[model samples]
Target chain A: MPRRSFELMETHIPSLRRYALVLLRHDEPLADDLVQDCLERAMSRWHLWRRPGNLRGWLFTILHNIYVNDVARAVARPDVVEIQDYFPAMAVPPNQADRIRLREVTAAIQELPDTQRQTLLLVTMEGFSYDETADITGVPIGTVMSRLSRAREKVRAASWGETRENGRRIT
Target chain B: MSDLPEIPTEDEIQALVDGRLDPARRAEVEAWLSENPDEAARVAELRDISGAVEQVYGHLLERPIPARFQNAAAPSMARSPVWRVAAMIVLVAMGAAGGWFANDAVGPGGDPNVNLARGAVKAHQMYAREVRHAVEVPASEEAHLVAWLSKRLDAPLRAPNLDVQGYRLVGGRLLPASDSGPAAQFMYEAESGERLTLYVEQNLTGGETAFRFTEYDDVSAFWWKDGPLAYVLIGRGGRDSLLTLARATYQELNP
Candidate 1:
């Protein structure tokens, strides 16, 4: 492959790592492992990636597929640990209150179903359009919208400390 | 009455929060939000969530990519016969240079010390010229810097005092060192504004080696291994000057 192609892929890695971090719910090592697998797969399949295409979306699609396959394999095993138990220990100190709130938001994101969390992060954090997100996640646009809405509502409720049972209904 | 503004849908509200809406639709959402306090609050909350996610996880973007992942593009390049021959020619040329070139052909699968030296040179070329962000954690917090890098590398690392050599500790950052695990880089600067970096990592293939020196363009490096740790001292100075600093580092680190 051309060196420029590799550089282009390199530019997307930060976003890829960020997306993977949230997807795997802050497990840094596992997230990096997923990214490595994605990069390797993408490199091996470089000919399959059409130029004049959304490379970011293509890469995310590869990462999401790898993650899904890994999850599928893990499902066959009974010893998987709850993802919530893996909240990362803070390496650097931030303002206590802000840290707590961010932790709450992260926890809320982790609690979301896989599809919803993926949709929400791809849209909100990674700034993918609904169409692009649908393409990446292999779902319809309407499904992306619904998953995003539900994911945002749950996260909003959790952050605001509003119980779904008693919170004023969101129309 | 026929010209009434259309109320935005749930998806439209989200689009507004994500700043994905077109101008006409965004204006309509803004107009609606102006009159609806509760909806506006929820939109604000959603916006906050995105910001918080960026705040919480954005630091990963600033990290140096691991050497293995950075080399992910190499496999394809390696498959090409032309590139393979060209790489072999370059490797042969480097190998003829002596001392440091002894293990130069080992590439990624070679001696751990050689990898340490190459990784250090790559990092120095990458960060030593930066006007800003030269190191992840500056030396003002030397104690904390050492502690954090030590924890990451899982070795008790120190930013060896180079002040006697007129080099002051600037700071250090954690780096991924191929498949060997994490590496730490500590940078130093002299009054002439010349900068040097010390790259340290755990020597998983544990044995000691004497100093090996190599130069790439203007930059030169001297790398050695001690029990449980490998070190590479990189600079733009003459080989002799760098060796002097390296020896000082060895003494301080060993003592």
Candidate 2:
């Protein structure tokens, strides 16, 4: 058995969890459960893990695949939730203004079409390079670039409280 | 080098904001930004959004690993509910005599304590990374977890209070302690999402104990035996940080 490789899988859990969280939009419990599923699959197929390349990217690709096949495939894409619901009702104020802004940013992120959100978080939050992000998301590098660019522009507009009508269309 | 690259494209600009731009092209982008105030501000906004996203969720990295994700070594070990409850009760009643038998069943290395420490660290590494199932039972059922784990390890188990240190009990889970017998892993999480695990197992034979510290991978674990229990405190922090928590655990349990 690939014993050392098994142990190495443990190291990637934190990053996988974070990526799962971002993809799931702050839904902590679901994100974590998804991570568990992803790790379980990776461990079972330890021999299949391509060494000398980006293991983190490989793990992420597995997670995104599971999500697409099992979860996202069933659940219809979620529409932008009420902006107020974006911020937890219990979140108190010293961070209130920032929280509200963050909520808007997240909602804008949530508002993104599924493909864009997936591409955007993989690049911006997880720090996956264009090539790696493309591999994980199973898209061309140019697509990853365009989706990320569009995602960023949307988030920028959201942060500034501008509506989509004011946003420029990307060619 | 003197020639300007075809007015760095939009993708190039986005690459700059994402920190993915090649250094060679980066200088061109910077020169481009310096010349264009509006575009620089846009890049600045993108950078802020990235920072805020990290700020919002970075703590997830530090949160305790849930029980469901702990045993990555054997995903099949996760049993159905009826089996889980029955196993919890039966494992404790059996008193890890099986593990004891297996201990001699395998060859011994020098210092049984070191072997125990290794088992402790292994358990720590596995369960400390979980989020949803960090513990076999959640803290809401604190009474049951204590009673169950106490019975299994055959030690009087009390969840240590590390409130002064800003760590609160998240929950505890049952772990196989290799040859030392079945062990209990108690998890605690700080407000900032940092986690610490205390691994407890029955000390089959009593001996004098002192704090012994070691590290595995990136995790630092401190273990010592006292009376009937051998304890290992593990976390991904410096030795000093783990020592402080280990000392706190010792005092709480010993007191």
Candidate 3:
């Protein structure tokens, strides 16, 4: 055990947690377990990590693969979620307007398709480049780009509601 | 759509927002964005969704680490692959300590520019997703934003206008610098929800210089120095697009 690798793994816990929370839709305990599983795998494979370009990206790739292979169905079931379910655990704003705004945005995100949601979250929220996202998701870079675009469009359309301007629905 | 030299494909626009386009093509896509406010705003909105996702879940990073993860220490003994295991045991015995493992993490590195770029990117990642609480002082208080950040930094700072580029000030916050001085970050957003951030710090010896681009992870930065203040414009766009914003910012701030 290099011990240093463990320290480095410690630094990445926050990132892994954030990614898992979003991916698992605010299920904190389940997200915790997923990150725990990820770290455990990384520990066992510490010697195999080939000190490459980005350890963060490598760790994310492993987590994503596990997510796809094992945890995808458990976490990504869209029909199971209702927008109202998003805020009970969160600190609700006292102001009604702010609460409404938060609800709309959260609902829009909750409505996104699974793959698009994952790709968009990884790219926009986590600051992963398209290449890094593709590597993590095991998809082509083109697929990552398209999924992000479609995902964003859907969220925008959902949050803003569609308005007709020049014969086209504008978000 | 009818008269432009070429319209960037939807994929290109997606790439533009993802900060993955190459320099040459980035300019073309940026030109398209500048010409099309509707498209630009839509792109900005798309970017905002990520911010929204981040805002909703970002607090997870601050939550206590679960015991299972915290307890997983690296294995002291390796039973597989005798040579590699022997090598690992030797290295552990030697106490080399990330000897060949550490590279390009956020820290005091060789290049000040790269370090600054990293800082800017990191701050951008941290707060750009915040909707109501993204900035310490909101854009509605622009005058106060400049005054407060300037006072804190002990250097004159301006929130560069990015209107022509279709990005408006989202607001700003004070950030602790890796060095002794303080740093400030100004976040801006296009109508579509794309965000670009300008990070300013007051400790550099270089005079006026050309824009240079660097990336840490997915965030891209375009930075330059004007006397003491170093300004870094970070966003999802590639070099050509970021260069355009950087030049516009430079002119506004310098003027």
Q: Which tens-of-lDDT digit does each residue in B85-190 have in candidate 2?
A: 1111111111232343244443355456656766777777777788887888988899999999999887789998887667889999998874746989899999
**The 10-residue segment with the lowest total lDDT in model 1 chain B:** B83-92
True contacts kept of 1: 0.38
Per-residue lDDT of A1-171 in model 3, one digit per residue for the tens? 546777888888899988877777766655665665677667778877887668899889878866776677544364534545544545532255445555667767667777887887788778887888998888898888778778877777767665413222212
Name the candidate, 2 or 3, with the larger lDDT value. Answer: 2
lDDT value, residue A37 of candidate 3? 60
- For candidate 2, the TM-score is 0.52
The DockQ figures for the candidates are 0.19, 0.14, 0.18
TM-score of every candidate: 0.52, 0.52, 0.50
> Across residues B1-255, which tens digit of lDDT does each residue of candidate 3 receive?
344648888887777766678988888777878989988877776655555555565655677775545445634221222121111111111112222113555358555755776677778988887777888988999999899999988888888877756789988989987465789999999998888889899866567555666655556677777777988788886644564466457657655
Clashing residue pairs in candidate 1 are: none
Interface RMSD for candidate 3 relative to the native interface? 8.5
* lDDT, candidates in the order shown: 0.73, 0.70, 0.69
Error of 3 at B111 (Å): 68
Candidate 2 wrongly placed segments (more than 4 Å): A2-5, A76-96, A161-171, B1-5, B75-255
